[model samples]
Target: MASVAFGYLPILLFLLVALGLSTAFVVLPMIVSRFTGAHQPNPEKLSEYECGFPAFEDSRAQFDVRFYLVAILFIVFDLEAAFLFPWAVSLDSTGWAGWTGMMVFLAELGLGLAYAWKKGALEWE
Candidate 1:
């Protein structure tokens, strides 16, 4: 049992080192900046800068929800590609069952996309 557990020692050590390095990189700069950086704030510096001009309109402009819908649609389809890779790699091992499973998954995705398309989610207007 101890020997089995010891087998993971290198992985554990590598993970610890990776975490330590990542933490040091993130925290060291902030710590150094705390001492070396200037600490002064004014309304001019705090005010929003837009296109090298002062704000003429309300910053919180209402945008169409279609932009977000398009983004979400892209993500849903993009994740389909991610799922395809493992399915393709294990195609032979999984045999007909795997093929059928992937078909069903793809069919579900197709149905969802079709539903979205029908609802004008894909339309710009």
Candidate 2:
């Protein structure tokens, strides 16, 4: 029981150090800014800046479907890239099975891209 408890000491120490560093990172910047007199709040400073443009229309205005389609496509492909990194890193252990799986995943993404292209989803105008 004593040896088992000791084995977790390193993990506990790591968690403590991580917690300390994270807390410092969050709190230190606010402390430094306050001491440096940069925490002042003014109307212009606190005002919202929408892409450097003033609010010209209703905030609840509906957007084009193409905008959402493009956004979804971007997220899908981004997730595919994220998965590829981990799969590639573990390729040695995963072997032929992993390679075939990744190939199939890529093929499906490619087909989706082709379908989107055919429907002019990639077009901006």
Candidate 3:
């Protein structure tokens, strides 16, 4: 147990130092601000700004379905691209099995893209 603790001593010391440094950084600014700052509040400063126009309605309004569809499509394609990196790195080691797996993955993605295209999800018009 002593030997185990000795092995972790460097990690423990690192954690303690990190905690102390972060606390100092956070507390020092707060202490300095208390000494230097005065409270000033105005109604105009608190209000949300609109593009040169006074807000006519509630800011939280319902969005269109197209925005969600585009977001989902972007996420799907982005995740597919992320998967490609690891596959590309180990291509030689993976051989036919990995190649077949990637082909299936790509085929599924292509099908999804085709479905979205047919549904007009990809169209801006």
Task: Give the alpha-carbon lDDT of every model.
Answer: 0.91, 0.97, 0.91
Measured over all alpha carbons after superposition, the RMSD of each candidate to the real structure, in angstroms, is: 7.2, 5.5, 5.4
lDDT of 3 by residue, 1-125 (tens): 99998999999999999999999999988888677873345777667675766677787977789999999999999999999999999999999999999999999999999999999998885
Which runs of model 2 end up more than 4 angstroms from their true locations? 1-43
User: In candidate 3, which residue pairs get closer than 3 Å at backbone N, Cα or C atoms, i.e. clash?
Assistant: none
Candidate 1: deviation at residue 61, Å?
4.1
Residue lDDT tens for model 1, 67-106: 9899999999999999999999999899999999999999
Each candidate structure's TM-score, on Cα atoms with residue i matched to residue i, is 0.56, 0.66, 0.62
Name every residue pair that clashes in candidate 1: none
Deviation from native of the Cα of residue 67 in model 1, angstroms: 1.7
Q: Look at candidate 2 and give me any clashing residue pairs.
A: none
lDDT at residue 71 of model 3 (Cα atoms): 100
